[model samples]
Target: MTKKTRYGVKFYSVCTTDDYGLNLQIYSGKSDEAEGLSKIQTLVHSLMEPFLDSGHNVFMDNFYNSVDLSGKLLKRKMHTTGTLRQNHKKNPTAITQAKLKKGQHLSKRSKNVYISNWKDKLEVLAVYH
Candidate 1:
């Protein structure tokens, strides 16, 4: 049940949500046996198994978002959208490093996925669509 921060360090479980807000306990991040990305993969699978092949969409913030994770979820017939970290593996470098003036935005898409980046304040925001 750890929380996500702008720094992109994640240490937690995966929860489910709906229009009413968080609706279920998908996985508990109470295990010490697993570490690093493997742990995240495990948590995501467990959290998503019940809805597999149901064509559900999962939305999360940066800490739980990654290109690999999204691909895996897609294979299970679950779609994902979230804020992605600029340095995430497979993230396009041009979008991540682009220096956009205020109000400027950049976007790209491949198949069912689209990525958008915009300048906000002093930082760039990367979103998965």
Candidate 2:
């Protein structure tokens, strides 16, 4: 098995699986950790552009989750569904502090959630399964 890290000389690969097994088509060495996203974006754009351009939903983990990156993917007309970090900021429009009347009943979910580093608020969607 090959390990993937943004800092080392490792191979990043994308694979397709079927009844037989996994087929690896692309592999490239990564050089820098800071340039990881841009490098991956370039690779994905070059190799997976066809699939992505077809409007397939791309799922990513929190490590690759960010508003800027998400916005870029959305710009390409690709739908994004990923697990956002728990500390992710809430959307400002979703806050209801202005509608509160002194001591109104407040549900836990209605509280204003904010992240210091995040400029805009994010809409939180909960899915039970």
Compared with the true structure, all predictions reach lDDT values of 0.68, 0.42
User: Which ranges of candidate 1 are over 4 A from the true structure?
Assistant: 1-37, 122-124, 127-129
Q: What is the lDDT of residue 69 in candidate 2?
A: 49
Q: 1-129 in candidate 2: lDDT tens per residue?
A: 888866644433434433332223335544343353565455544444665656666555554443444555656666555544544343223332324343333222222222111222443322111
Error of 1 at 116 (Å): 1.0
Over 4 Å off, model 2: 1-37, 85-129
Q: Pick the candidate with the highest lDDT.
A: 1
Error of 1 at 59 (Å): 1.0
Q: State model 1's lDDT.
A: 0.68
lDDT of 1 at 91: 77
lDDT tens digits by residue: candidate 1, 1-129:
988755434434445453453334433346543344466666667656677889988887887777667777777788888888888777777777888898888987755566778776865544554
Worst 10 residues of 1 by lDDT: 20-29
Pairs clashing within candidate 2: 90-121, 90-122, 91-121, 91-122
